[model samples]
Target: MNQSATRLNTEELNLALNLLRAGELVGIPTETVYGLAADASQPEAVAKIFAAKGRPADHPVIVHIAGVEQLAAWAQNIPDEAYLLAQHFWPGPLTLILERQAHVSDAVTGGQNTVGLRAPAHPITQQLLQHFGGGLAAPSANQFGHVSPTTAAHVRGEFSEEVLQLVLDGGACDVGVESTIVSLVGDKPKLLRPGGVSREAIEAVLGDSLEHHTNQYTAKQRVSGLLDSHYAPRTTLITGQAARLQECIAEKLAQNQKVVLICQEINTKLDIEQFLMPSSPQAYAQQIYATLRQLDLQRFDTLFLALPPNTTEWLAIHDRLARAAHHRY
Candidate 1:
């Protein structure tokens, strides 16, 4: 790993902010994942992000703002639901879909009338945005349809030698998964995706019965993570009950298949291969991405994942695991 490519500081922040202001790309840290950030208000800078990620033009970027006050500046007709959600979840992993103000770029919104906006909880990101003095149009700091990068080193792995100017290393992400996406554009509140924030958490803050509509990703929706095959690892991922998954692992080992087992605990002592995550939910969430990234590099033929516990707290982990495994609905 290049030392310069994976580290940044306050001085680097100023330099990166200058690059962003001048319509150049910079990799930024966030609680969710590292993002390839550009000035959201600049069309040219936003286009570079899509080119670097090989992301589709129609796939919208989340405009990250410094604070809640800036929300009204970019988003129009902010609803009561948006306000409540923002008050509770801002500076965290929660992206809200709202109607775009006239001045907001269609490029940032992917030609949609509405745009996705977030106030990330990461201090480095907040400082960079505050210095830049505008929203940043950023997507996950990796190639499109690839596993999102949780660490700055992971971000550098995506680029060739000189494409990326700087990667602001802020260690591993706290929320290994993306933000919970809620759309406030419609009459009723809808969850576009389940993530770090639970639906129950959102309801607790709203203090009313909220209707959740299932808007399956269509060609027209252009929502993030809507693609059927995404968040994948190089190795084939098989998911099932812990016991059954363990059995599968044993069977594969008997056949001398190259297999790696990932779970919260390892009961059966199989010497073939295994990775154990912490038993607690918070610990599990924090380590999920880094674990998978490591296992993916080991040249394993298949990955056996023990299904996490069925509980609200495990929702985000389950979602990311299911996507990585590419299980049929």
Candidate 2:
């Protein structure tokens, strides 16, 4: 973290809230990524988020509220499952999709009748929302389609000296990945995205009868972070089995291509560049984006990645990497 980066206090919080109230952007921390937040009700303020991140206007942003009590204000006809999930995972990283209230701006929902909403569990973020007294539409604080930022320095690196008036530094995010987005507006509990909150966890709270949604790449409910070619590094990425990955890396090296390999275990004695993440899923999820962000800066010819095990625990990480490597198709 930069020593000189403005730290959050009561006074700084007030200043950031003022900016948000005035329809300006403020980088607020969440359990997932630091988000570029703007008042969700203000179409102009929400537009600033898309402009700041260079995000496509078609992609929707998640409306983050202070707590579950405020859900009805932004989302209309809240389902029973929404309340159940909120009771279990509010003040945490789990976004619920429900029909939007008439007042909820179409800009925030990308013109969809349903809106994605969540109450992030970061204290500074909650305080900022409570002080601002409104829902904030926030997307990851980075250039669109790039790796998300997990720390304040990451946010600063993206917006160096660009007059980003306020950033609430809440240290590194705990879940590291984005929220598990479940849509309850349909007939059953439909999952829009796999995130830090695993399906098993949700199933444990709900039951096996809960329906899991697949990534169909549809135009109707185009959510943020679910695009085919997103969360990518500047360099090309290849993901697969370890032995085959080693062979592919060697082939790349034979072609005089500089490469970096990211894996859970550094067992292979490959002379090329390599990095290892913790074997634990939680720790790996926390560091995955940051590692990719760092390696993306090296300007390597390609990124040779080891495929994570085909298990439910690694679903979110795999989903992200798969999207990052979509161009290989």
Candidate 3:
């Protein structure tokens, strides 16, 4: 994997702080996913993040802070709901969207009026943010619209050494998906994206149901993972209706295609390898990305997946797979 030798000690943190302070991007680990972080205050450095990831300029990035106190500095009209949720979920996988502060650069918000902010739970990243004492605009440390990295080695595999010089090695991510994004820009709070935090949990805290983004950006754009087509791999992916999975596999085999089944249903009559995943929400969320990346590494010709039950817990997994199977969408 050619993992960077840079440790997460005082020396490494000092080096990362200097690189970021000088307007350069460094790979930082969070419980959700590894992020390519740059100084949010430096527009040029933030722009470099877009260039490196080949991310669209209009797609917003999350500004990670050291703690809850920095929230007001970047977002405006702070709502009690944000604090309530952050109090319970900060230092975990939750991102709140609020009206962008006037001084905050539109570049960080992808020219949108709102910004996403979070206080990640990883100690290494928390330490880095504390020492830096500034907001860092970071997204998944990988190519735009690709499978996100869950480990330090995965980040190294995503970019060349010259491109990502120092990846803060913090082992595998605990929550393998992005943060749950709840936007408080309008009259009500909306769920732009779901991650480690389940909607039921968030709603329980807010005492109100959240709105859903319909992806109707006909006139304007604002989101991180709402693209109709994203998080795809070079290998083809086929999402089949749960009941009709066998039919889908049969059709694929009939066509002489190599099939890799990534679901619970196992039909021994079928002559293909199957990888079973945990039905439990927490376990599935932690392993989904690493599973996809492993399949991509195996150079599989096709992946046949059955949909998990359409429950609140499986929301984020469904969203990611739907994007991975962008062709069907």
Candidate 4:
């Protein structure tokens, strides 16, 4: 990693702000993931994000704001539920979908009537937003449909300095996945994506269970990270239960194929390559992407992860892993 690309000094922050103000992209850190950020008010600047990432134009990017007070600047017809959730989860990882204000650009909303907004908790990003005093249309700072970057170095590795000149180093992301997306557009709030914020926690705040609408064909909206095969690595990835994965390892080794395993327990008898992931959900989320990036660099023929339990606590992890894997049992 280049030493210049990972600094969080006043000079770097001011440079980032200047770059963004000038309609250029800057990699900004959030608790969830590093974002390729552009000033939301600048449609041309926002379009640069899509061009750089090769992201589909229709796939909307979340507009990150400084705080709840700025909500009306991007969205309108706000519901009480939006405030309730934002009050609890703002400065954290929760994105609320609401009717877009007429002035909110289609570039940011993906030509939809609604826009996604969040107030990220990373202090450095918060400071930047405060100084800039505007929304930043930022998606994960990696290639489209690839594993999201979780650190400043990861962002640097994704795009060249010429493409993304400044990356504010806020260290490793605490919540390693994207923000939880809840849509308040229709009659009922829907859980578009489960992520850094758990669905249960969101439901508790609204006192109503959110409708699970992720990856549904009939769905009317397109949001980030919902594509069937996203967050994938260049190397093939397979995911299954412990026994099935162990069987896969055996089958692969039998054919003289090189493989690696990411699991909670290391079966030393197998004798290939293995990484022991954290047993807890939060810890696992924080490390999964960085782990995948690390292993993907080694050129393994295949990578296998022992799927965590299919339970509410692990829903976010399961969602990401499911999308990342080429094959799932």
What overall lDDT, based on C-alpha atoms, would model 1 receive against the true structure?
Answer: 0.80
Query: Highest TM-score: which candidate?
Result: 4
TM-score of each: 0.91, 0.93, 0.94, 0.96
| Candidate 4 local lDDT, 1-329, one digit each (tens) | 11223335787778888899999999988989999999999999999999999999888999999999999988889999999998998988999999999999999988989999999988888888989899999999999989999998899999988888887888898889899988999999999899989998998989998889768464577888788999999899999997878788888888888899899998777787889999899999999999999999998999999898788989999999999999997
Query: Candidate 3 lDDT (Cα, whole model)?
Result: 0.84
- Candidate 3 lDDT tens digits, 1-329: 12233247778989999999999889998989999999999999999999999998888899999878999999898988888988999878899988889988978998888888999988888889888898999999999988899898889998997887888988788888888888877778888888889888999998899877736373144778888887777688888675576776778788987779787657577678988988887778788888888998896778877777788778898888888883441
| CA displacement after TM-score superposition, residue 95 of candidate 3 (Å) | 0.9
Question: Between prediction 1 and prediction 3, which has the larger lDDT?
Answer: 3
What lDDT would each prediction earn against the true structure? 0.80, 0.82, 0.84, 0.90
Worst 10 residues of 2 by lDDT: 1-10
lDDT of 2 at 112: 87
Which residue segments of model 3 deviate by more than 4 Å?
Answer: 1-7, 214-221, 327-329
In candidate 2, what are the lDDT values of residues 1-329, reduced to their tens digit? Answer: 22233346868877887888888888888888889889999999899888878888878999999888999998888877788889998988899988999998878988889899999888778877777778999989988888889998888888744536777788888878888888887667777788968888898888755565446354246777777777887778888878887777778899999888888788557988789878888888899888988888898898878877879889888888888783331
What is the C-alpha lDDT profile of model 1 across 1-329, one tens digit per residue? 11223334668877897888889888888888889988998998899889888888988899999878889989999998898899899988999999999988877988899889999988778878777778999888988877888898899999864678877877788787888888887667777777778888987887765454333342235667756666777778888787667667777778888988787787666675678888887778777777777888988988888888989788767777767784421
TM-score of candidate 1 to 2 decimals: 0.91
Best by lDDT: 4
